[model samples]
Target: MTGLIKKYIVYTAVLIGLLVFLHAIGALRPAEQYLSRGLNPLLATIYSWGTNINVAFDEQTGKADLWQQINDLQAETNQLISKNAELKAVEEENAILREYLNFFNDHSYEHILSRVISRGDITNVIGRTESILIDKGSTDGLRIGLAVVDEQGIVVGKVAAVKEASSLVRLVNNQQCKLAAGILGSEATNGITEGELGLTIKMNFIFQEVEIKKDDIVITSGLEETIPRGLVIGKVSDVNKENNELWQSAHLIPLMNTNNLLIVSIIKP
Candidate 1:
């Protein structure tokens, strides 16, 4: 097989050499030129097809690049939206802090600001938040029975338990919470306002002859240690006469909803 391949290669070389010799004498030169000229159009067509393939490849690459740019822009837009929401929340909280600072200034009270961290809910008693946790605690000069108020000087609760870094505030409507309160216009009819059913403030043991009316404002009487007077508690929502012939009671709606209290001030002793 090797000998046969070598013989064929020798024959091919001899044929090419004979052809070159004929062309040199001007015998096949004209025919060779004619053949080359005839192939020029086909060569040009092949070159054009290669150029089209290159253009198509470039166009595909450009489309891929364009899609990548669009995805990058979408991700940036989402980041900006999240950043804007955070800024708006910060602005609103700053406004709340400023209002509280000014209120304490005018009222001439020493106080510390605290942020509410969490809330307490009784699953058995739906829709009631009995207490909340604040960021400030015993380390921040917080202790039990210290009155806590919202930005507008509305009493919301008192510090019930304290830890090194946090404290629990029993809301004004918690049954365990009681305040020495006075009717806005009836100082002589001062009574203790106790939270009833984790829902409303019920001032009990009022004499039946006190002549109390609905919508009367109740406030702290300054009778308890560390609690200031004139802090708004709520308005009388309903009045009830006692079954025990000697006493009467009324329901008071809290001035602020505990569910919305995110910041508060602890009145210093």
Candidate 2:
């Protein structure tokens, strides 16, 4: 133990002598500058690594925020589209109701409003007679032979069959439907109008010299017990006359389209 203590004291004395010699020659200052230069690159590399780590973290956070905003905007756009569709449907329904109300106010006839429910059997014999099923029947005072009119008060069809809560309407273009009609003019020529092959109406038995012309408005003559006068059937599209025949005929086109029927009124006398 005593020998080891002596060796340590000699080593300390030697390091003190060496430091004193290096300081006298200005060697300590040069060594300090060299050491600083060598360590500079290491310190700079550590600082750059720290800065890069921080920037990468910030970029990741920004990307996450941007994605969240895009999702929020997409949800808002879908909600707006659904609301717009609902509003459009409501507007169309209101327009249909308004048209029905106007038809009620324009005429003094007693009528029952009915909706077309379904189409009945289509007999394609001469042409195509389209029959529609309505939501009114004997329960709603609807019966066979009741004149049905469109929203504009133009004659559309007549009730052919009725049930407890439903009725079948034979359209004006049906071959079985016939109306006593007359031209609306000074020399009002009258004739029997019947559906030709369920396509168009033909006014037969008009006197050749009765002064009928094309585009003349035709109306009911009120000769039938069920139909009323002045109900428009159609307009005269063509006047057909044979040179040897004593009578002339007029092809009539219905004012209302039967295929597009939605709501109709049954004229209740």
Candidate 3:
């Protein structure tokens, strides 16, 4: 134990002497400015390692903060996209409702609300007819010869056949469907518009001497009880004059997009 004490005391004295010598030479003074110049490379290497450690720690903290901000922004963007989708859906529903209201206001006669069920014919009634099916029938006050219409009262077709809970709508595009149509602004021009395919119609039986132009609005003339007056049929798309025949052939663009039908009204009386 005496020898061990002696060894530790000698080691302590040596460390104090080395520190005193370094201080006398100013090696420990102006530490920041002179450390590199006076410090032994081995000791300087340890100091440089400590400084590098601190710099790396700061850089890691900054990177973490940036990543956190990016995550926050991504979350906000997702929320906005979801909200926009919901708003669009509501807007579409409102537009559809408004169109139906306009039709009811203009015609005060008789009306029945119906929803489109399926397209094409289920029973295949008249082979010459283009038809769609509705979810309302005899149960909903629907009957044959009643006019089917879109939300805007645009002439769709007449209910030609029916079951207990469903009915068939003969589209305006049916080969057998015909309507007496008049040019919106014309007093003397009148013709019969008949359906073709792809929801298009042909305004036939108009004399070559009749004046018609593109984009002219065509409406039902109420000449028959099948369709009401002032219901939109289509717009004049093209006109072909034939010298051989007494009537001119004209193409019509149907007011309704047949494939996209979702809601329709029935003219009861």
Candidate 4:
């Protein structure tokens, strides 16, 4: 035990002597500076790592926020599109109502305004014939034989059948709805205007000697009890006369296209 203690005291004594010699020569201060320089890079590396981590976290947060903003903008755009479509539909309805009102103000006859709801029969042969369903009905004083006119007071059709809320109009171009018409000219030849095939009107039974020509206006003769006088039916387009036959006929072109009609007035009187 004494020998081991003597060896430990000798080691401690040597370490003390070495530290004293280094201090006397100023070696401790230079060594401290060297140690500080070597440790500086390690400390700087730790700080750089911390800064990069913070920047990465911020970038992740910014990306998430940007995506959220894009989703919000898209939702707002869809809402605006829906609202614009609604506004456009309202504008169109208002324009149609305005046109009906203007027509009522200009005409002197007693009439009921009605909208065209359907065309042709269940067979869907609208192009071949002139039959349309109107919104007005028996409740609105519409009945069979009531004359229907367009916005410009031109004769379109007559109410052929009526229901409580709707009615069927047999247009002037229909084979069943014939009009007693007179040509507006010096001779004013009178004839029966009948609907021919393909939406054409033929004014038949006119005297061959009558001075009927193309572009002559044909109007209702008012000989029928239900129809009024002077309602423009159509204009003459072609005249067909046979030297052997005593009667002549003329093809009439209607002022309004029956298929394209939107609104009409039912002549109440």
Candidate 5:
């Protein structure tokens, strides 16, 4: 037991002596300072990396906000374009109404204004005449054989069949349509102006001795009861004369175009 005690004491004394020698040489202070300095540089580098990461995150957030604003502006631009198109359509319709007003004020005939609803022929006693349907009918005091004039007061057609709310008009360019017409030049030469091929007018049955020239204005000769006098029909394009035949002819182009019939006034009987 004594021997064991003596060895334990000897080991303890050596350990104490070694620790005292290390403390007395000033090595402990330098080592402590060295550890602190090395740790400081490592800590500072870690902090700098963390700061850069935070700054990059903030920049990414700002870009996301700016991108959203651009999308919102693009959506607003499309809505404005649709509104502009509707306004332009209204302006065009108003201009057409003004033209109708001017034509009504200048004429003296007992008339009723009507719009062309369709452009197709109806059943007629004179066979099929290329015709248009008007919106006015017997309820509006319209009847069969009423003369239809255009917005320029030029004869375009005559009402052929009348319904309660609509009427069919035989256009002047129809082959079945015949008007008592005359060439108003130095002296009036009256004849029947007939439609040819649904495209032209031909004033036939004129006397060969009559003096007719190109560009002469042809007007109604007032020979028909429903139609009146001085109503312009067409312009003379050329004269066809045959010495043997008693009848002379003149080719005329109608003053009114039936292809774009929009509005017309029926001359009431």
Candidate 6:
């Protein structure tokens, strides 16, 4: 193979030398048409190959960048949506406060707004007594036995104990609790409502002769020194008189939902 390559090299050199000698003697002609045809094709192929590689790389980079941008935009959109929802909730709470304020002003009810600071969690078996704590206490004119009420003048609880700046309230739904309530639209007939659970209170001890109906508002009679007069206790939901001898039975729905209470008032007097 080496010998054959050497022979070919010698022949090619002699041919090139002969061509140069012919050209020098004015016997050789320039093949311009052949040069243009053969070299142009080779150069065009190389250029086209290089252009294809460049375009493919550029397109890949653009696609990667577009995907990254889309991910970033999605993250930003999610953050904005969460923030909007939080703001809307805050606005709704403020609207509720404004409504209560207007009603208090309009009725000229002696009142003060107290924010809820702590609450009883039923899951916490240690304090299943169903009580709530507020920020107001003896220092803020709250007493040990003061009646705690919601914005709508509905009794929520009575202050059980007071500290300098906080107080514990026994909720109206405490099973051991009892209050004197007057049946509205029934000519001042009063009954005793006792806490069945932390959910509802039952107004019992009505005389067998008294008439009771559903949807009747029950208010505190203020007969005792514990709760004030005219504070809302609940409204009757159902009434059943199974026999003429049995005392009329009724179900009372508390005016306040303890789960949603945020602000309340402690009746000082």
* TM-score for each predicted model, relative to the true structure: 0.58, 0.56, 0.54, 0.56, 0.55, 0.53
**Residue-wise lDDT of candidate 3 within 39-139, one digit each (tens)?**
33444345346545654565577696775676468446434432343344345445676978653232364888776655675354433337776667675
**Could you give me the TM-score of model 2 versus the true structure?**
0.56
lDDT (Cα, tens digit) per residue for candidate 5, span 1-269: 99999999998999888778886885565665455445544544554465456545655776966745653563343233222222332343346668776533223568899877665644532333378777777768988877888766677888888765677888887776788876653224378887787778888988888777787777776677887655667778999998999988999877674544567899865
Q: Model 6, range 1-269, lDDT digits (tens) per residue?
A: 99999999999999999988886775643353244334544544554465456545655776967855764684464344323433443454457769777533222345556766556557733423467767665556777777777755677877788755567788888765567777643325378777775677888877777777887667766665756556667778888676755677778877665654667788765
**Which candidate tops TM-score?**
1
Clashing pairs in 3: none
lDDT of 2 by residue, 82-141 (tens): 233334434544567697775332336799998776655765753254677776667678
- CA displacement after TM-score superposition, residue 196 of candidate 6 (Å): 1.4
lDDT of each: 0.73, 0.71, 0.67, 0.71, 0.68, 0.65
Residue 102 local lDDT, model 4: 52
Q: Which runs in model 1 stand beyond 4 Å of their true positions?
A: 1-106, 242-244
Quote the lDDT for 182 in model 6.
Answer: 70
Is candidate 2 or 3 superior in TM-score? 2
Model 3's C-alpha root-mean-square deviation from the true structure amounts to 35.5
RMSD values for the candidates in order, in angstroms, are: 34.5, 40.1, 35.5, 40.1, 42.3, 36.3
Estimate the TM-score for candidate 6.
0.53
Stretch of 10 with least lDDT, candidate 6: 81-90
Off by over 4 Å in 5: 1-107, 121-129, 185-189
Q: How well does candidate 4 match the true structure in TM-score terms?
A: 0.56
**CA error at residue 36 for candidate 3, angstroms:** 97
After superposition, candidate 6 runs with Cα above 4 Å error: 1-109, 121-129, 186-189, 240-246
Residue 214 displacement (Å), model 5? 1.0
